[model samples]
Target: MPGLLQNKVAIVTGGGSGIGRATCHRFLQEGARVVVADRNPAGAEETRELMEGNDDNSAVSVVDVSRSNQVQQMVNDTVSRFGRLDILVNGAAILIRTPPLAEVEDVDWDLTMDTNLKGLFYCCKYAIPAMLANGSGSIVNIASMSGVRGVAYGVPYAVSKAGVIHLSKVASAQYASQGIRVNCIAPGGVDTPQMRGSTASAGTFEERNLEHPMGRVGQPEEIANLITWLSSDQASYVSGSTYVIDGGAWAIAT
Candidate 1:
């Protein structure tokens, strides 16, 4: 069978590592040309290396999605290289653990929103026109369960993700008549290098898993699988919805 994304062209932001990196590889596995965009050049290169097979099918753009101009240029570059944009995975983000809403530093809150929420806005803003020109598109923004049920010590991160969830809804409404689908995915306790770095221990990791009814953290590829499906024609009828893949975290939280 032909892959789900056969002949598609996709841009995955934060494609240097974690969910972004995994999504890029998954897109490639589904037969799509990929542009791996990230603020981290080294991490982007690592993803490119990991996805190497057909050199002509992949490219890398080092960009901070928080910058509108840079985000615009990255979208322009993708079209220049691939001719049309078909799919987008906005997966770039920063996770900041604040002391409390009362004590959270202004700098930390601003940085989190700028990177996590504003960045997705910029990507969608620029990528939309390109997709419109192509007459169809699919966008999957990686949100977090924090957006839905909130997180302790994660006010900034949680709020930004909530914004992302709404952004997807608004964009979906704006573009659905024009043949585009927009959706968000909320993942919880994913086991990535970033996650491991954030928690810092196997014991702490187990405790975090205990918070989920599943008793295990998610894997990056597990999230990637859902992203690819949403971006594929297989999900032609899905849009403007938030899919939670958080090991039943929301159920237990509520």
Candidate 2:
């Protein structure tokens, strides 16, 4: 049997660590040519090295998705190298400092919005046109459970993720007829390095886990698995949908 994404071309932003890195690995395991884009040059290089043994179907690019020109070049470089564009996973994001809406500084708000929301906008702005030209594509935007529910001390983060969800929906609606599928994955407490660091500052990691129904945080690979499936043709009929990989966190109202 062939891999799920055999011969597909994929771009995974933030592909240096956590969910982004995991998704990159999953995409490659499924036989897709991957472009691992991240703001951390070293992270991208590490991902590239980790994937070096894989057959000639993967590369990495240092990119700050928040920059429009950089994002445009990232897409252009992918197309130039692979000759086609198919899947785009917007996984690059920053966690806002936990502060009350009134206490959040302008710089913090701007950074959060720029990276979480505007970055997606810039990437889609470039990737969609390529997808349109190809006549078929899948875009998976990584959202957060906070996007759906209000989180204490996470105002900016929640708002930005909410924007991502809505942006993906509107884009999906507008492009469905043109063969481009846009969807989002809203994950709850995932045990990534970033989440661990955030939790360390906010509270105990175990306390965070208790908020979830499963009493455990999700793994990066779990999220990556869903992303891989969503990016595949197997999910052909699924578009404009938000798949929550939160282990039932959103299903409950505490």
Candidate 3:
């Protein structure tokens, strides 16, 4: 049988490691030609090697989505090489625990918002046009559980994601009639390099794992599967929705 996304073209930003990288791999498995767009050159190439192998099934675009020009260029390059854009996964984000919100500097605030929120905006801004050319498309923004709940865990990261949730909602509503689906995923604790690094020590990760009712954190591939489904025709009727894959933490909290 052919893959779900056979003949589709996709761009996964922040596609170096963690959820981004896993999503790239998943997209390729579903027969979608992927562009692993990342700010880190080494990480991007690593994912490219993992997915591209010896074929042109996948490519890499070293991009800092925080920059509009770079984001524009990434989109242009994707179209130039792939001929069309079908799926866009905005998975680029940064997490910073501050010395309390009072001491959070303007630079840190800007960095978090730029990468997490504005970066998604730039991708959506450009990718929508390409998707429109195809007459339909799907855009998935990787948000966080903090965005859904009024929590104080990493103020900048949480706030930025909250913006992303609303961003997806607004954009989805605006373009639903145009055959584009805009959705957001608010993931809880996933076992990604970023999640491991977010804590002070390895022990924290283990403890955090047990905190979830599932008794363990999530895997990047788990989230990746959901994202790829959303991008495919399987989810053609889904739009303006926020899917939470937190392994039951959010379930107990509410």
CA lDDT of every candidate: 0.92, 0.92, 0.91
TM-scores vs. true structure, each candidate: 0.97, 0.96, 0.97
What's the TM for model 1?
0.97
Q: What range of 10 consecutive residues in model 3 has the weakest lDDT sum?
A: 48-57
Worst 10 residues of 1 by lDDT: 145-154
lDDT of 1 by residue, 135-254 (tens): 999999999888988578679999999999999999999999999999999898898876887787888888988888878889899999999999999999999999999887787767
**Would you give me the overall lDDT of model 3?**
0.91
Q: Residue pairs in steric clash, candidate 3? A: none
List runs of model 3 lying over 4 Å from the truth.
52-54
Per-prediction tally of clashes: 0, 0, 0
TM-score, cand. 3: 0.97
| Clash pairs for candidate 2 | none
lDDT of 3 by residue, 1-254 (tens): 78999999999998999999999998998899999999999999999888744178788899999899999999999999999999999999898876578888898898999888888899999999999998999999999998989766578888998999999999999998999999999999999889898877999998999989999999999999899889999999999999999988998998
Error of 2 at 142 (Å): 0.5
